[model samples]
Target chain A: MDTFLQVLIAGVTMGCIYAFVALGFTLTIAAAGVVNFSYSEWVTYGGFFGVTLYSIVGLPLWAALIGTVILCVIMGYVFQWVVFRPLEGRHFLTIVTATIGISVSMGALATLVWGPYPLTLPTFFGNGTVEFGGISFFPHNVLIIVLAIALISVLQFCLTKTDIGLRLQATAQDPDAARLMGIPVRRMRTFAYCLSAGLAGLSGFLVAPLFVVTTTMGFGLMLKGLAATIVGGWGSLKGAVFGGLIIGIVEALGAAYISSEYKDVIAFLIIIVVLLFRPRGLFPERIAEKL
Target chain B: MRILSKSVIAAALAMSFAQVAFADDIKLGMVIGTTGPFAGGEAPLVNGTKMAVEDINAKGGIKGNKIQLIIEDTGSEQTGAINAYNRILDQEPSAIMNTTVSGFVLSQMGTIGDEGIPTLTGAASAQLALDKKGVEPLFRVRTSDLYVAKAAARFAIDNLGGKKIAVLRANSEFGNSWLNQIQSVLTDKSVKPVAVESFEVADRDFTPQILRIKDAGADVVIVSGDPPHFVVAVQQLKQLGLTSKVIFSNAGVLPTTIKLYQGDSANGIYGTVDSVPAIDPARADWAKRYREKFNIDSDYSAAEYYDGVMMVAAAIAKVGTDHEALVKEMRTIKDYAGIGNTYSYADKGDGGRSVAIVQIGDGKLTLAATIK
Candidate 1:
């Protein structure tokens, strides 16, 4: 029973990370109607940016995180203006291919700058763990869970309640009509892209201390985030979170009960099963339909 | 006009002869992954090889003929390795050094056997490489995982007195081979591991695995993984409060790895190493030279490859670059001391039998015991 609880907590912690990455995918796909295959590189670059600020530049952890966010915001805008803006109404495959190219280029650039060795981030929590009710939790894990929930709550509130959120939703649903109604659809799209990039940057910053920061780290998370987005239903924010949690818990349980070798296989099997039953996803884009 | 034409033809003939004479230099081909996942290890190997070539050439060359090294990047893949091998064969190299990855080296066995070029490798520590049927020309400078595992098992049982052991290995060719050898050694000693877990190479979170190991009440944890993964596991182990004596395979003995775990937390962790520069002044000097040259800290891979290059140079000098003569000379080398270890190729082409047990003490690698 204790083992089960510990694994559950571990799974949830990992699920939160997946959810954060998946949310980045969700926001971009909803806004642009194209999947950003290079979204994971944003996470990787963000983590390395933090490494530069914290380890190389000798900034405090909080300052480093802020620097990462600012850098990611600029990166997001540049990617939009330079890469996506030119490809605006082109073939969906063309945009995705460009994103893949971006991903590869970023990985190469990182390797050229930092070399292939993985870098370590100093943990803010100093390797401390908290035990309560016979459950032991690393402070980093607790922080990840709490921060993920808070970020998601803020995102949900903004998307559902704010006027800009309505405009963003309006643009995603029908850019033609949104523009006809005097809404700046392009601006909303850029804003959504920047927001999504910020979320990915935050996830990267949070995960670096737990794992080694390497250029390839984002590629792995990209696959997981794609799996989550697919399983949860495309363009469904709440579904992305659920999909991530489900993937994480199932992987942990599979590793515990079945075999670690087959954990990834089991997670993909769940995706297959979900696709077979719910062709669209567990939660389809109902908001888009309503709009 | 006829005299001018005749002069041009004569000059062209002279240039051709000069080219042939320049090509008479002994050529040694090196296939390494200078770019990709194995780049970290191969970079140092390349530097060490260059240093050996320079040192040999500075001493009036081997047999008064300057050695020419032809380097090709394997890109850490079998296809890339095959392409590199083909390119090297085009140059008609007298000998070849295979890449660091075992799988890539094994993939090139047919070519190595058919060509019969004298080959030496500092990587590819799999025992099967020694026992492979078509590896007659291939020699290993690095000791196999079997020896490292035997040394680790003996230390765990005899030195540390660990009864309930836990084995956590990366799911890789090297890791699996080491795990099997360690298990065999432990089973012979009438002890079985309390828990066994395997993680993928890219896995970051080991919380569930470590928790399970702790639940099994293991007194010792034997880790077989690469440096980055090993560092993460050690940090996670400390975070989870599992104070079991951790023993690492040779893969985790890099100085940079130790730097990641500096201070008290790093103390008492044991690992098997091929060489520690602090134990020998000659090795220390070699390491210092390497650092000054490459601007990076040297590891066992660099030392072994340095010795390999020197051995090849000596062989070329003793016997001309004839394939059969080079092979025979390499086989006859007995206890030829190098920067890393004294290498003696057994009948099966396995050399370097020395393995040392070392502990991380006060942010430094301290020699504990030598296993021969």
Candidate 2:
């Protein structure tokens, strides 16, 4: 039972990180007809940003997070204007290739800027632990779970309750129609990129305490998020979030019970099994992109 | 008859010219990691080897002849390592150095012996590397993984006063070696393992393994794997409030490991290391010069690989262009002082296996003591 609880906590924390990255995937797909493969870079941005502020410059923990998120949002706009905007009416392959190019460039940029060393962030919740009913929990783990849930709620509200939300829905549904109705589809796409990157930045910030901030850190997380998106039902926010949790839990259970050596492999194996059985995904596939 | 003889002489001269064009240079094949999950483990060696080459050449090189190291990335995987070794063998380097994979070293040894190339690398952890007749053509530069485990066990028993211990290992050469070495030592000391948990290297979640360890009422957790496994285990340990001390092998206690745990949780951790980070007053000048050149602190991985390359240079210089002679002399280098360490390569068939222990205190990686 204690072992079960331990795996459960690890799964939830890891799943939360995946969910945060997945949230970025869902938002970008919803707002733009193209999935931004470069969303993973935002997580790296968040981590490096936090490391600079908190470890090097010695900012308060919360301030570093906020600053990193803001920088990530701006960086998303830079990508949109510099790379995504130019390919507005190009072939899907062109757009995809361009995003891949962006990813490669960002990866190199990360390597050049940070060197190839791993970095750790200061623990925000202190080095304390809480034990309840024979199960113990790290303070950071609890804090991150709370933060992920809160961000989900906040993002959901912004998507449903704001004027921008209506414009975003109209753009995603039919960019031509949205434009005819004065929705400014291009601006909406840029806005989505900003929102997506903000979430990734947040994910990076929270997970920095757990994993060192390395150039390769975000790529793995991004791939995991992509897997989550596919398993939860392609392009569905609900599905992506759900899929992230599933991947995280499967990894924990596999590491705990099956084999620790294949913990990472287990996450992908579960995704494969889900995909083999449900071609459309565990949930209804949402139309995140349109021709 | 005179006209035919003159034509034959001209043909012979042309044939000799063609032979010179296609002659093979003395290529030193190397399996240095350029990318992948384990890239950090071996990148320093490549850079430091280059520095060693320059330093040697600064003194007019090996017998006034320039040495070349033909390096290829091992990709930090088994298949990648195999492919790299096969390609490097095609070039037929006079000597080779394989990076940090025990399996790769053993696998490539047969080919190395067949090809008649002497390989010096710190990556292989097997004792069999020293067993020449049936060994790989490669020699290990660092302590054998067997020695590392013994050092870990010694540190646990002698310093940490650990009697009952828990073992957490990844299912790799590193982990397997650690488990075998420590298990034997623990048995000799009559300390039964409280619990044993194994995980895959790729597995990020360690909750199940940690929980099993906690349930077994262990006093210390000995880990043998890459930094990620160690980080995940340490983070999960803190999360579960399981304060059983973590005892990691040398590779387990890399600088990257402390960075993974945010330096705070790294406190109170004990592990074996290859070399001290040259911070002592005795080695401060060396550290300062290395940092000034590379913008990074000097580590044992670099120091030892640098020594290996220099040792190769010493042999090559003595033999005066005889590759076979260099290999023979590499085994008999007597009492040569290097970087404050003695090097006399004993063909007892493996290079010496030695270790040091380090303690993480106040978020800094500090040298504790030398563990034999």
Candidate 3:
């Protein structure tokens, strides 16, 4: 049915966004051994940065996106050096708490600078709907899905086939062993943080036109990303993507068939069911023992 | 006889001191949500309240006593509102202006009634507020959601000829109230909505909901929600290729929301508003001044709050800050025209029944018809 296809496409589009943010969560957790709770705020900052560049400064979409990435990367490094670095050798709980503090502070800062009203970004792709096989889809939605898939594939290739990727893997596996192999483990961790932040920023930039840009926007995405990571598998990139897609499709279907009020509840129920049946998630991280 | 006279004199002196303390300056307490979900409209409400106080004082103050406004921020939660109400009560203000959220107002109704402080709310329009017994001291400056919903339903069915309607609303007090009223009015007209969906205030994706509405083949979609969410819903509805007519509740009349979707996506979306200053030259001048002063577009909240503050000032001036007298005076106010709308309280303290249907036109709200 066209309605079913439309819902499917919509779910996939949302799932892709969840996957991007989940990728950030998995990247930070894998590389740093501490979950960056503030990862979603990076996405929010990225959107605000895009608003400044595109809406206020009148930059082209691509140029504004590039500016957003640069700013987010710098912010990632600044947060790492300023907040996470000093607590590097401290207890894991300390780092997590610090990340929470960072998240709150970043949200408050965004609100202070931009106020609470949501800002609009110019649509990059044309706003027209394209009909394909009797189902209508927005060009922007298609672009988002394609871009998310491309980004994920590129990240996958880099993680599997590059020297820096190997270094990152080594650092995440065992910092002491990685350092012994002359892998500059700390620098690799910083690099992972930057990449994760950049991904979050990119997701924000891409989704801003679809949704309104607000400081609280990242919080919802962060929760969804966390849910995806939990449902897929901790510290598994592929699992995060799969988890995000699963959440998106399940939520859409649940809302359509059941009640819209329970859509979020359905997502949480899936997380619980996954945790109960397989604590390691739907796709358990298998490389730990191998590494 | 001498000892008893001395005690009476001391008691009289204490009572006189208390009266002097109360009369030093007329204090009005304001509870506004400056953070959390409601912060989007906080700036204008606070600015309007402040401007009203300034306007009053500049005119030689109420009977030469300067009106003082003590503001408290309800962090957009019931507990926060209750706490702020308690703090405001500690100041012993002559009257209180509560927050915009109906849930917060409902939670504090018993307390407001027990304290017998004449309270005015600019935005909370839940019918439950009026349905409750013992809410005598509570007054609403804005029209109730029930009234606004009736107007919206009439416009959609009567004017737009939307036979098959779909209702989409946020799951909040505001949304729920509007839903009930719209359903009641539509049922009375023997037209039932094809589909009804509710989303959370923070929800960004309405694709699933829109798809369902599209499938139902509704001729028009009636929406009731806060800003940005409404804006996103409209955009999504357009994107989903559902060319159904869209009608919005009073909450959707915001200029900022219209500007967010100013293109073809925003055209022909109808909404009801308490007032459109462009219709009245005097109101237009006030709106212009308010925009210049606050650097934000003037919405119903700003205008209603300004009028609310002035109403409190007027009551204080007429009754000299007597709590019971002030409550009586507020109820007795009849057709007191403010910048936004006229205030005339019914026996139960509900005011402002005038509304206008406005359609989005070229990034602005153009008045279509006035309903009383």
Restricted to chain B, the TM-score per model reads: 0.91, 0.88, 0.91
Model 3 misses residue B47 by how many Å? 2.9
Candidate 1 vs candidate 2, TM-score winner: 1
Clashing pairs in 3: none
Candidate 2 C-alpha lDDT tens digits along A1-291: 766876787798888888888889877777777777777777877898988888787889989988989988998888888888888878877887878777767766776677666677867767667888877887888888898888878777777788998788778777898999988888899899888888888888887777667666787788889888888877677777799899898988887777665677777877888889987788754463242
Q: Which candidate has the highest TM-score of all?
A: 3
Could you tell me how far off, in angstroms, the CA of residue B204 lies in candidate 1 after the best superposition? 0.9
Backbone clash count for every predicted candidate, in the order shown: 0, 12, 0
What DockQ do you compute for every candidate structure? 0.48, 0.34, 0.50
Q: What is candidate 1's TM-score against the reference?
A: 0.91
- Find the number of clashing residue pairs for candidate 1: 0
Error of 1 at B102 (Å): 1.5
- lDDT of model 3 at position B196: 91
* Candidate number with greatest DockQ: 3
Query: Candidate 2 on B94-180: residue-level lDDT in tens?
Result: 677777666766666667677767777776455455553334345557666677778888777788787679989888777787888
When 1 and 3 are scored with DockQ, the better candidate is 3
C-alpha positional error of residue A271 in candidate 1 after TM-score superposition, expressed in Å: 2.8
lDDT of 1 at B234: 73
How much native contact recovery, as a fraction, does model 2 achieve? 0.47
